[model samples]
Every structure is written in structure tokens, then in C-alpha cells.
Target chain A: MEQISPFKRLIASSLGKKYLMALTGFVLVGFVIAHMLGNIQIFLGPEAINTYASKLQNLPIAIKWGFRLFLLTAVAIHVWTAVLLTIENKQARPNNYADEKTVQASYASRTMPITGLIVLCFIIFHILHYTAQVIFDYKDLHYDLNGEHMHDVYSMMVLGFSHWWVSIFYIIAMGLLCMHLSHGISSMFQSMGWSNEKWRGVLKITAILIGAVLFIGFSSIPVAIMMGMIKPIIGH
Target chain B: MRLKLKVWRQKDQLDSGRLVDYQMDNISEDSSFLEMLDLLNESLVEKGDEPIAFDHDCREGICGMCSLTINGIPHGPEKLTTACQLHMRSFKNGETITIEPFRSKPFKITKDLIVDRSAFDKIIEAGGFISVRTGSAPDGNAIPISKSDSDYAMDAAACIGCAACVAACKNSSAMLFTSAKISQLNSLPQGKPEKDRRLLSMVSEMDRSGFGNCTNYGECHAVCPKGISVDFIANLNRDYAKASVKNLLKTIG
Candidate 1:
């Protein structure tokens, strides 16, 4: 018999794929929470948020590129592994029960693949709209704060979400992202063997709480902008 | 009680099966689900028609031979109960009950309501055992096992290999079944010798068996006739991770 390498075996096995998914998902979850926190800074006024944005922009090039590279890899691996697992799962049940029924699985748990795919699309569009600034030409929205000129991310976000359709799309995508995380959070714990009977209930509630917080936090920006509660800095 | 049953009837592995409706009259509500099937089979035989082919043994539910998806639920609506143990009283009069064989990629329908579940046996064959020397029975207290460990091991040992978990899972994953077997052995002192090897071999075999990966939807435990918990799967994940890392380190060393 041929001796397969342990690294190869880990990637080849179903359980191994789950470990990869869980690890990458953990990274992505951390990024999402941090990203939400950063986005909510806009509520603290333009100076606070613009200062935060400038700080991030002025970070050492190596650290910035390193973080971006890490995040990109995490997203890629998470998506690639999910696609493979979903294909395998679909093939496993070629013939489904005619009278299908769900017993204990949550609505969020059952619709993970759909929610995940939609969130992936949301991430792509989000990057294009905000980071790339190509969606709506926010390139000229520069602000001078403390005699330092910087990209006016605050006004960019405000103007970007001022469009009713854009806000609606953003809100809808956040809803799906929340749904995905509700299941994905606790599921990552189970996949990593960190959860069990005693902690299952607590973990589930925690997952829902995190998802709820992210939804409210991320959606609040768009909602506030649409309501004119958080206006862009005048004469930017 | 009168009832309507839409039973799946597949002549053979290659045949495209269909649901054949049977109107049964005067069925005893107290009768077991299998007994109701027997009554239906007898009527079909009397009519000079082919009877339904289903698997059942140890009607009390211990043998794990009975396999049927009663109305999309393996072992019917009752919790911690097998089809052989499910009484007809659970259903309403004139209710249209749909019955189908346990479906999965690895479990092909051999006939009507009969699927080949030998894939499970293959997983067991991989490492579901301990290599013990043939000798006289040793004293039970030779190995001092903690009360908690033994109790946990006993809980895992309750699995009857029914594959109801596999049938109930949308992914058709056998993680629950494979984990139960692993936990049952891995928890005991006697099974400690080949712990790493057992976890490695059995998990690899389970992956190769064409079963889907567990997504933690947890439908498996919900329909398990033995009330097996998904905690065993968590344990398996932990054990497999440790074993894989240890093996990899050893190879590098």
C-alpha cells in the first residue's frame, strides 16, 4: 500500500475539509466584527471616523499588505472549501425524501449555502463600492483634517448610501450576512470540537447575538445615512 | 383503523421506482409499524400480486435491521424509537403515509424499501475494534476507569448502527454513526492502545465511503432511534485533529 502524506490526507478527508472551513471561517468572523466596529465609527462624527480612516491608510505598507493578503487568503480558502463540501453534500443525497421534513435544524442552518453565496456577492460589491471607489467615483471626496488631506471615507459612505436602491441592497445583504453567521459561528465551534452538549445552547445564543450585533451595527450606517441622521461633512 | 400508504416500490437496483398507494382497512392501531406492513403484504399476496420487500428483524428494535423512512422521518415521528417499535396509533385514521427506503449515495436501493447499507460495515471494518489476545476473561476492575468515562462510554455504546442518522441528514453524512463507534471505543482504557490508529483509519474510511461531511445541521441526532448525541462527533473531531497532528509530527521527526 502506498503511504499518503499526512498533509495530503488532511485535505483529502471530509472531516479535514471541515477543519479548514472552520479555521478560515474563524478568521473571516473576526474580520467581520472588526470591520463592523470600524464602520460604526462614522456615528462618532466625521473627524473621528476620518481620523481612523487616515490612521489605517497611513499604516506601514508591509502591515497593510500583510493584513490584506491574509484576509484575501482566508476568504478564498473559506469559499473554495465550502464549494467542495456543498457539492459533496448534494451528491450524497441524490434522491431526497419526497415528503421532506426538518426537525431541529434552524432555518438559518438549513440555508447556509444560499446565505453564504449571497454574502460572497455582497463582499465583492462592497469592496468595489468602498475600497475600490470605482462604483460611483468617490475619488475626489478628499478632506483636510488638522491640516492633513485624506480620503473622505465619511462623505464617501454617506453619499454612497444616499441612494435608496444602494441602501436597500446594503441592508438586504446585511440581513443575509447575519443569517449566515447565526449558523456559521456555532458551526465553526462544533467543527473545531470546541462545543458539546453542555455548551451547545450557550454557543447557539452567542452566535445569534453576534450575528444580531453585526447586522444592527453594519445596517445602522446605511439606515442612518438614508435618514439624514449622519450627514456628510459640508463642502468636502 | 383505515389508512392510505404510499410506499416506494423499486423492483431492483437499476429500476426507476415509484410510490404505489395501498388502502388498508381495519388495521389495529396498537400493531407495530412492521406488523401493519405485514398485513399489507399478506393482502397483496392474497391478491396474487407481488408483496412489498422490506427488511425487519428483532421487531422489538434491537437488531437494527429495520430500515424505512416513514413520512420523510426515519423511524416515524416518535423520538428514540425505531420503525419496528413504532405503533400505528401514532398516525391518524385515513392518513396518507409515505414510506421510502433510507436514501444515500452509498446506500443503493436493492429492492422495494430495502437499501444496501454495507457501507457502514466497511467503516466498522476499518478500525471499529480492539486487538486483544485470546485468553481467559480478566477481572472487571483491573483497569480503574472513572465513573464519568465509563458512563460516557456506555452512552456512546448504545448506538445500534441503524443508519437512521445517515438517512435523516440532508447531507447523508455518517459523522454521527462514525463518531459514536469511535467514542465508544476511544473512551475506554482497553481501547487506548490503538486510539490514534483507530481514529485515523476509521475517519479515512468514512470519508472514502462517499458519505457527505457533517455541517452540524444536527438532524442526525434528532432522528436517531438510540438517542445518540452529536457530542460524540465533537469528540471525534478533537481526537482526529490530535491524531493527525501527532502523526504528521512523527513523520517529520
Candidate 2:
């Protein structure tokens, strides 16, 4: 309309951030599923997981690096956009009522970034324990499984889960991921303009399915290792 | 019938407002809600006291200027009707109605039951229009909007901008009000060119104006005199996303 008030620009641009949040979030969900699937190779055997890891590493070195770089960009853009939008929402109001409660958005929608941040921390720890070790020759830590010097992939995962705090963190972080995905998936559809009245119900069901699959798939890895269903390969 | 009412009284936006009690009697059931308030004003005038000032226009549901919040429900205990059209017959004789201004940080209180609604105008000003010039009245049949699409768009357009959505919402969310405008023009071809720009600007203005995020309580639609549905909000989210992609593509290409 009138070009006088520059305040309009700030508001108009926020809709952009909303799109950034939804699209980046949807792409990240795909990453989460793939990451969990990669981790599940531990259940197969050390040779299976190491072979999988080596193959992932062997793929056009630049492309592998490029993919990681792309993932980082997606994560950074998503967080920065979310922060700016949150600031705009908060600054518009000076004094809000104490009991301000939202009536419509699910718990996941409200707590996305908080959960997202947690998942981010989990990713860092995961890289340190597994990827970092593979990359840099860190101190080889292991548990005495039948007095064997077995620091294979299976042993590393099982030993890591044996510690109480690490297992607890994974469970909590996955819970957040599930909560984030529960709302994030549905919201992604809304953002993409896929909200036909007839299909809203279908989209909702699909989101629930995706969330449930990731939750169960992620939680199973640590639980199985902690339960000792998968053992360390000795003297590999 | 006689009744005591706890009406909010304030001199201006800077004045501290409070619930001031007053009594009125011999009011008729058939009298409109405005008439009941008129009788209260008459009594106050006779007593040499300043009559409680409020906002009202058209005295019909169509204008949406009546800003009374009776019994915690916007526009009183009525459905799809503004306060002016609400009749006293809906309430008992001895009932003391509690009236408050819509509590939005953007809607500053000008006086009792009267707040400045310029925030809505600001929201509209922040890109609620297309680039078309007002040359003359366009023919209705020139731009053929689908019957179903037209109905849905009109349903959103029916929003009177009363700020009841803000008043009725626990979080003071403007989702219904904001989304209605977004969806109304978004469904039609005339609104296609600036669809993304319009939605992006309005939502930013909404957030900038200090309105809370929609928590989906559905109270806004329930208390709305227009009975606008929450589905419009979902439509807003949908269109906003498309606008973003469209904009991004334009940037890259």
C-alpha cells in the first residue's frame, strides 16, 4: 500500500522465515531417518557397519563433504530464521498476561526450537563418539567383554550405552525429536500449500506415522545395545 | 428490570481504568443492548455525572463497531451478531453484566469499552491490497470466481474486523482475524499477483503489532460475531508457505 511506514517490511519478511522454518525442518526429518537407519547397521555386525561406513566415506570425497556442508547450511539457516521470527513476535508486545496460553498449535509446534537444539547437541555428541573417533585416532575406550581388546563399532555403541548418563541423554533427545517431528511434519504440509480440506486428515495421519516410525527406530538402537542383544566382535 | 452493572470507566488511554458499579432499573426485555446502555447513560446524566463513553456505530451486526465484551464473551452471549443487535431479552432482569475493552497491547484504550483499533488498519495497511487501480466498478462476471471458491472467500471476507478474535482469545491471538484476510483474497485470481507479498506483510505486521501466536483454542471463532471458522487459519499457513517458495524461486532464477 503506502510506502511510508517501514515497519511493514519487517512483518512482510517474517512470512519468509516461516517458510524457511518449515522447509528446512522437513528436509532435516529426512536426515534424521537416514541417520537412524545408518546407525542400525550396528545390529547387523561390525563388519557390516564398518563396511557401510567405509562405503559412505568412499563416495566422491567432495560430494560427501558437500553433503555435510549442505546439511550444516540447512541447520544454520533454519535456526537463524527461527530466532529472528521469535524476536519479532516477542517485541511487538511489551507486557503480556502471565497465563497466556495457546489454544490451537500442538505442544511440538510450541517447543520445536527447544527440541531442535537438544537434537543438535545430540548430533555433536554422536559425531564425537563415533565419527570423530573414526576421523581422528582418539583414545580407544572399551569394556572387558570376555577379556578381548574389541573396540569395534558394536562394542563402541554398547559401551557408550552402558553408561547411565549417555543413555538417558539419547532417550531424552529422541523424545524431543519425536515431539518436534509430530508437529513439524504436519506443519511442513501446511507450509507447502497442500492443505485441501479433503486431504488435511490424510496429511495428519501420515505425520503421525512418520513420527512414530522415527521414534521407535531411534529408541530401539540404544535399547538393544544396552540389553546386550548385540555383542562386541572380539579381536577384530 | 433493575440491575447493577460493573462497567469499566476510564478518562483516556493514559488514565487508570477500573470496574465502576452503577444501577439501572425498569429496563424492557425487548430493548436492544444499546438501549439498555442508553438508559444507564440517561440516569448518569440526571445525576450530573459523566455518562460512560463507549464505541458503537450502525447499531447492526454488519458494522462490527460495537466493542462490548459481556460475561467474558465478545459481543455478549450471542452468535454471529454484534453487540448493537444483541437484545436484553437474552439476559435476566437482575443480571449484572461485566464489560471490558478488548485487551490487546496494540489496541490502546481510548476510554471505557472504547479502544483504538488502528492496529487492524495498520495490519491492512501493511499489504492487504493488490496493485489494481480504482478506475471504475468492474463487472461481476468479468472475473469468474468459482462458486465454491467464491463462497469460501466471502466467508473469510465476512470478518468485520471487530477485534473479537483478540478479545475472545486467551492468548490475545489475532490468527482468525489475520488468517481471514489472507485466505479471502488468496482464493481469487485478482489477489494472485501480490498473494505472497500480501500475506507476508500482514503476518509480520500482526507479529510486529504485539499480537500473540495462535494456540488453536477455537475460542476466537466461537465468540466471533461473524462465525468465521478456524480452517481459514490453516489456509493462511498453506498460502504463506507457497508465497515463500515462489519468492525463493524468483530470487534464485
Candidate 3:
């Protein structure tokens, strides 16, 4: 009843938060696709992926960091709004159903919050493992390629995945990421009002395809490393 | 058929309810679920015990006045059937039935199995109508409508304002009901003029009612006596997104 701004009213409601989630989620999904494609270059050998990484790193600092900052902000908003909406949703049903049965919701849909939290943890660990290079010793792995000063991303990945525990963890994290995406993708379309009964089946199939692709593309690196298909480059 | 009933009993709105057990024998399987309840109430009255209170108007499923969560499923175990239409034969000979009121914050338990459903009325009052001058009835053929559009509109109009969707939802969301009304009106030529404003106001009003958000559980249509599809909710979400954008631009401009 109190006077409020239209924008404030827009994002303050449950429907508003869902719209926010859908928008930001679409951004994150795009980043995931691009990241997977870029990383899959490793299959061409150390030079291929390293060159791709260097090209990305060599961009203007403003452009590079600006994009990173934008992604980080998107992630923050997505997580924060999800938490608020979840709390409100919980408050809506104070008494839990004693003999509840999920008749139609998929396992992925039912476990979205849990999978989301797990994926968040994996993302933080992933950034620490690769981006910050602080989770493991990668100082010795950095070297120049072809007179161009570049980080040895291939060696770093090989070394990181060669360890059984890290490889297993990465694979597990990718699995959870796929599960998260399976539900999030179709749900994004639903929230955006881009889906209907006719296309609902198609949307779900598309979600599964995207999730599977990301899973296979990302995990292939670590799995291949563990299987000795990809090895650490001898030197610069 | 002999059955054991675990019916919820509450003194008043402030009091917490609990399920009390009662045995009923000689129940004919041909009798509807509500009729069985009526038989139980008759026996209770004979014993000078308080009878269970429930809401009912038409014994047929059309009215939707019956609101009960039978065995944790709204409208009993039968799909696309209201509690009034649910017969005793759906259960086993000695099966125990757990009957409770539709639980939601906005719908407070008024008594045993009856809860206040005026929250639905409040939602309808928000924007479920058109402002038109009173005049003689217009000919149905005055406005031409495609058969498909009319069918879609009628499908949505079949909703009986039952809160089964809310009860079946894990979060107690009312998206299905709200969307049905929005879809019904906005699809018609007569209701097209105020479509944008209607969507914005109705959705905001739904949010104001303290109902949970729809996560596409699909249970709403599964248990809907009228078989209202969750697709209407999707239709609503699409319209809402467009309306929100238009309204925001209008306000700023």
C-alpha cells in the first residue's frame, strides 16, 4: 500500500525475482557455452589451447576485467535473489507436508537448491584452482611459448588433472553442474515466457542436450588427462 | 465397505487442528466421498458428538465448493475429479483415509475440514472483470472468434476457482488459478483492450496475497478436477513479461 517506485516494485515481488533469475541465468549459460568451446581447444594440443588462452589474456585490461566484473555481478545478483525468493517461498508454506509425494517434479527440479549450492562451491573452487592459480603450485608450470610470454595453461591443466583426487573432484563437479543446467535451462525459458505446451517438450530436450554437451566438453579434458591421452608438455 | 477415517478436528481459527480417528462400517462403495463423510457425521450426531465441518454446495464436481486434501492428494485419489465426485470404491476395503483442509497461509482453517477460501475471491476482485456499461445482451455472433481461440479460452474458463492447485503445490503457489483467469479473459476480443493493465494488476495482486511462486511442478493440472493445464501459467508468464516492460516504459515516458 505504501508508495514505491516501479522498478523497486518490479524486482521486489516473487515474479520479479524469477525474471531476474531467468535473465542472469541466460547470461551464465552463454558464458558456459563459450567457455566450453574455448577450453575444448586443448584437444588440438598444448599450442592450440595456450594460443587461445593468450589471445584472451592479451585483450585490453579494461575490456577483460570489465567482462569478468560483469560476470561476477551477474553471479552475485543471481545467487542473492535466489536466496531471498527461496526464503519467501519457504515462509509461504510453514507446515511441511507430512506424507508428501512429488508426482510430477523431476529429480533435477526437486534438488535445484541443493545442486545450485554445490555448483556454487565448485565454481569458487574452480576459480581458485585455475584463475587464481593459488589452490595448487603452478609457478613452475608458467613459461613462454614461441618468444611470446604466456601462461602454460596446457601443463597446468595436465598437472591439475593427473592427481587422482583433483580429477575425481572435477568430474564430480561437472556432473553436478550438468544436473543444475538440465533444470535451469528449460526453467529459464519458462520464466521468460518463451515456452508453451507445444514447445515444452522441445525445451526440455534442448535443456538435456545443452547440459550433456557442457558436461562432456568440460570433463573430457580431466578424463583424458587421467587416461594419459593428454600429457604435460615437456618444455617451452 | 468398512473404513477407518482420520479426520482433522479444530475448535476455531486460532486453535491448531489434529486428526481424530473414527470407524465407519456399512459404507456403500457406490456412495461418493462426501456422502461417506455425511454418514460419519450422522453417526456422530446420534452419539451426541460434534460432527466434522466441511464446505459443499453442488454435490456435482462443477461447483468446486468442496475443498479437501484426501490422503495428501487434493480431490482424493482420483485424477480430474473433485472430492464430491470421488466415490468410496476408489479405496481398499479396509483402507484408512486421511482427510484435512486445504492448507495455505491465505486460507486459514475455520473448522475441521473447512478453510476460508475468500483469498480466491480477493484475487478475482483485483482485476478479473471488465468495466462495461450495462446494456442489452449483445449477440454472440457480433464478435467473430476463431474456433481455436474460443476453445482455448473456454478451457481456461473451466476452472472452478478450486484451490486444488494450491493444495497440490509443495509451495502452496496459486499460479495455476491466477493464470487461468488471466488466460481466459485476455484471449477474448472483449477482454483484449485492458490486457496489459489486467496482467500487471492481477499478477501484483497475486503476489500481495502471500501465495508461493510456481516452480512448474505440474501437479496443479494433474489434480485439477477440470484438467486445467499448467500451460496457462506459461501463457501468463509470457504476457506478464511483456506487460511489465510496457508498463515500466509507460511510467518513465
- Per TM-score, the best of the predicted structures is 1
Is 1 or 3 the stronger prediction by lDDT?
1
Better of 1 and 2 by TM-score: 1
Q: TM-score, each model?
A: 0.99, 0.73, 0.95
Q: What is the lDDT of residue A9 in candidate 3?
A: 71
DockQ of 2: 0.15
Instruction: Write candidate 3's Cα lDDT for B1-253 as tens digits.
Output: 9899988899999887788999989999899999999999999999999989999999889998999889888898888899999999899999988888888888888998898989888888888987778799988799999999999999999999989999888778899999999999999998899898788788888888889887766778888999998789888888887887787887899
Alpha carbon RMSD to native, model 2:
5.8
Candidate 3 pairs with clashing backbones: none
Ranking by TM-score: 1, 3, 2
In candidate 1, list every pair of residues with a backbone clash: none
Q: What's the lDDT for candidate 2?
A: 0.75
lDDT, each prediction:
0.93, 0.75, 0.87
Misplaced by over 4 Å in model 3 are none
In order of DockQ, best first, we have 1, 3, 2
What are the runs in model 2 whose C-alpha is more than 4 Å off?
Answer: A1-12, A98-102, A133-151, B1-11, B15-62, B66-101, B125-145, B166-179, B186-253
Instruction: Please give, for residues B1-253, the per-residue lDDT of candidate 2 as tens digits.
Output: 7777888888998887788888878889899989989988988899999998888988878887889878767788878879999998899879878877777778888988898999899898888777788988999799888899999889999999999898777556787888998788878899887887888778878877877655344678778888898788777877766665665566557
For residues A15-103, what per-residue lDDT tens digits would candidate 1 score against the true structure? 89999999999999999999999989999998889899999999999999999999999999999999999999999989888888888
